[model samples]
Target: MVLIRRMLAFLMLASLSASVPAFAHKDHDRKQHAAEAMHNSAHQEGAPAASRMHQEPMHGAMEMEHSADEPPLTFTDRLLSWIGRLHPIIVHFPLAFFPAALFTATIGRRRASFATPVQFLVVAGGALAPLSALLGWLDAIGMDPDPLLTVHRWLGTMIGALGAALAVWAWRKPDQDRSGLMMAALTVLTAAIVVQGWFGGALVHGVDHMNW
Candidate 1:
């Protein structure tokens, strides 16, 4: 009876010892799984912040590239800009002379005395037209392209061409007012100048400048 009791006690002790190792292994596995979960969660939480940190420098680099694209203005560019500014001042000469030529040319048709003044006005206006157009082109440098700009540019070009043609005609002819062709050309040029003035006013003021 004593031997049986000792055997039973030894079996119980072995079973208990085996169960302790399994319980310890389960606890270790649970701890390992929890540690892995914490690491994964931390990484996920930091990912967006790390991504933003990386993007900030990239954005700054893009801005630097954009800024570096434009070179510094040279002396020639500055000189040209200065010359271009003269466009506004020089433009008034042609503006006054062309319309005055039209008036004189019309009146000169009746009186030979007015012919000299008509020829003078035409020559002065014609000579200044090309210079004004050139200066205006320079003034418009680097301006953004738009509908009004297109119309203004082409209109100025046409006026310059017409002015040159009229000047050459007057130079060859004895009396421009007597010639029907010269009178018609003068009328057309005057009309164009008037239209140009309106566009220029629109540019200075607003599209609604004519409303009043």
Candidate 2:
């Protein structure tokens, strides 16, 4: 049963992460519109010589701004961007692990043998959650900021903190959670994951992401 559960969880994670690209596709249109607007604004009604004079300095300033926006295409920038891209990939692990841990912890409350697996999942999930959050921060560097993005950022950070704390709590009180504190914490962790997922989806797919 445990093996089957683990296999199913892996499959779910794989499917979820694989669909991230599709969710992000809408952003491309928004980006294109913004680019077009910038281009159009750069050309304004005026005398030809006056417009050229105005554009020259503006063009130079825009170049400088673009350079500041993204680091030079050096090895370090490339490597960080590559790792940052892995945010989409790595995020699924904790998404799977914490929920699995919640399940195991709940079941393990009655069956003590299941505690070990819960601990394992919690520790693994807890560690990776922060790494995933860090990668997300790096990846968001050039992203357009919005309310959804702000909420996702803070919520993701909290999830990482809660996951890590849950791991430590489970470790420190390996056999004394009969009061169901760990179970409750795990439940809250799972809830946070769900809410964070929605915010993330909304950021990529817009406010109507869940509209049927």
Candidate 3:
């Protein structure tokens, strides 16, 4: 039963993970367009290669062919792409773990027994947050630049850095501080994640994805 549940969860995650070749395909199209434009100019100068390209009208027919197809991904390329796709899945861990840690820490104010869970959650989030951020950066490669992407990328970087620092702070000071500084810090981290999530959704859906 446990194995079945785990398998189902894996399947769900795999379904959510999109293939990376599409991103690379966009890069390829840009390069192809640039190359063809250069060749088009060269054809004006009677270059042999451009002479051959002029045999068919690009805007009328050749453009359709180039736009319709991209080079196929090899098994190894797919395998490597799977690594970057892990970002979407791995990010959930810190999102849950950080907030849960904050909650656990809040409750631990009344019951000391909650201390262990708080520390464990913080440590777990710290371990995964950097990996998630790294994968996110990898996934962003070859994607078109945008303001939303800029905000999401750097914000995620900050989250990963702060998460690690928060974990270290938790480990060093298991007991509450006089000012509750760690709790305050944890709150900031959680808030950042929420904001980053908004930008991420905008990137995935559209800028007005949440519009009424």
Candidate 4:
């Protein structure tokens, strides 16, 4: 009976010893899986931040390249600006000079003694008319193309023609009584020039339709 009991106790101890290795393997597998899962979670959490950091420098580089590709403002820009500044003053001279010449011519013809001064003013005003017209045309060309430019151009041509005609008449008149008639015509032409000048001024300063 004692011998049988010892053999049964040994068999029970052997079975318990065999199960210990399986429990240890299962615990090791669980720890390995938990460690792998923690590593994967950390990587996933950092991915977005890493992507943004990579993209930020690329975005900054692209912006820098775009700015570098742009052209700089040039000397033509400054020249045009100066032309625009002088435009109004150049245009106004003919407006004043033409009318003054006509007035002086009228007074001179009435008195018959002041014709020389009137003739001189007429020639001077006529010479200035074409110059003013040229400058005005240049200024118009610098601006954006518009329908108003057509009107301004035609008016300038008409004024130039009338000024030239008046200058010739004043120069050629031979102390004749017909000087009064020529002066009267000049007065009427000057009136028309004044109206045209006003229209040009409105185009520039009134609606702000022009570009420098």
Candidate 5:
């Protein structure tokens, strides 16, 4: 249990240190892109109105052509893109851990000796949950906004938070018996995971992912 807690603490620190700068840099890039877009819009507005109207189609085509001719991604960019693609793979860890914790805890309620294992699962889940969420955000940072994506992102975030909370609850009361409140929280976490999993699948497989 001590080892699990230490690992989680380490992960928290690493995530903070790594994410802050990466996100800051991404934000800077976004602001720069937005400013450039706005400047181009302003330039178009300053053009003769009739000419602007006549040139709109050509302007869009030219932008597309320019994008097509843009240089390929640099090595670093390609590596980052490959890393971003790992989100789906990494997400399975927490997806299994939280539910597995709930299951272990449920069984542990009957057998007192299962407490240690329950604690282990909770801490493991908590540690990986945030990492999964971070990877998801990085992967989707440049994706087109959509309702399903929005729901999946926020719900996945909420589940990660809940996983962390569950770990803390278990750590603080390591030997304490599971109370009604803890059971209820576990139930809610499980349900949230189910819903979040649906949304995640829908994001990848379309809304009919669970049509059956």
Candidate 6:
């Protein structure tokens, strides 16, 4: 009976000892799995910062390339913008002068009261024409050359010369029929200047002639 009891006790202890190794193995496996999961999580957290660092140089290089491709603004551009604004005002003098002179002279020849004012308009117009021509020439030369540019140049020159000639003749005349002749010359010159001004407008606003 004692032998039977001893055998039963030995069997229970052996079974308990075998179960301890299996529990220890399961615990070790769980710890290994936790360690691997922590390592993977750490790598995932660092990935985006590493990617941003790798791409930063490429973004900087692209920006530099874009800057290199763009052209720089220049002094000539500023001068041209200023001149463009002034061009319309400068062109009107020649358009008004010759006709005003003629009208005044005709009225003065008939009535005598409109002569002085008309003469003043003629002289002022004549003076303004040359200045306009000079500015026009500067604007033309500053731009790329075109076929129509020559026409503008010659017309401006002719208008300026005619204005100056009429002005001089008007100045020299002693308030007689010769003043009428000078007024007629101014009238013709005024017509010519108006045509020239129209062409200049067409060159600027209509065509791409003067524009860069």
| lDDT top scorer | 1
Q: How many angstroms is residue 2 displaced in model 5 relative to the true structure, after the best TM-score fit? A: 57
- In candidate 2, which residue pairs get closer than 3 Å at backbone N, Cα or C atoms, i.e. clash? none
Per-residue lDDT tens digits for candidate 4, residues 1-212, read 99999999999999899999989999999999999998997788788878889999999999999989988657886676567567567656667766776677655656766666666777766776776776666666547767667877878877877777766766776464236576676777687786676677668586453435
List model 3 lDDT by residue over 35-95, tens digit each.
9998887767677667667765765586778866978777876766778898999999999
Each candidate: how many clashes? 0, 0, 0, 0, 0, 0
Comparing 3 and 6 on TM-score, the stronger one: 3
Residue pairs with backbone overlap in model 6: none
How does candidate 2 score on lDDT? 0.84
Q: Lowest lDDT 10-mer window, candidate 3?
A: 170-179
Q: What are the per-residue Cα lDDT tens digits for candidate 6 across 1-212?
A: 99999999999999999999999999999999999998897788788878889999999999999999988758987676577566568878767767777767776776666656766776777787777777777666556777667888888878877777666655665365236567567667767866776677777687654566
For candidate 4, what is the TM-score? 0.53
lDDT of 5 by residue, 1-212 (tens): 99999999999999999999999999999999999998998788766766879889999999999999989878887776777788888888888877787788787787878888888887888888887887788788668999999998888888888888878888888875266677688788789878988988898899997887
Candidate 5 deviant stretches above 4 angstroms: 1-67, 71-79
Model 6 TM-score relative to the real fold: 0.55
Query: Residues 70-160, candidate 1, lDDT per residue (tens digit)?
Result: 8988999888888988989998998898888887777668887888888888888889999999898888888898778778888998998
Candidate 6 Cα lDDT to native? 0.74
Whole-model lDDT values for every prediction: 0.86, 0.84, 0.84, 0.72, 0.83, 0.74
Assess the local accuracy of residue 212 in candidate 6 as a C-alpha lDDT between 0 and 100: 65
Q: After aligning candidate 4 to the native by TM-score, how far in Å is the CA of 144 from where it should be? A: 2.7
RMSD, each candidate, Å?
Answer: 33.3, 12.1, 16.0, 37.1, 19.2, 34.9
N/CA/C clash count, model 1: 0
Clashing residue pairs in candidate 4 are none
Error of 1 at 60 (Å): 18
Instruction: Write down the TM-score for model 5.
Output: 0.64
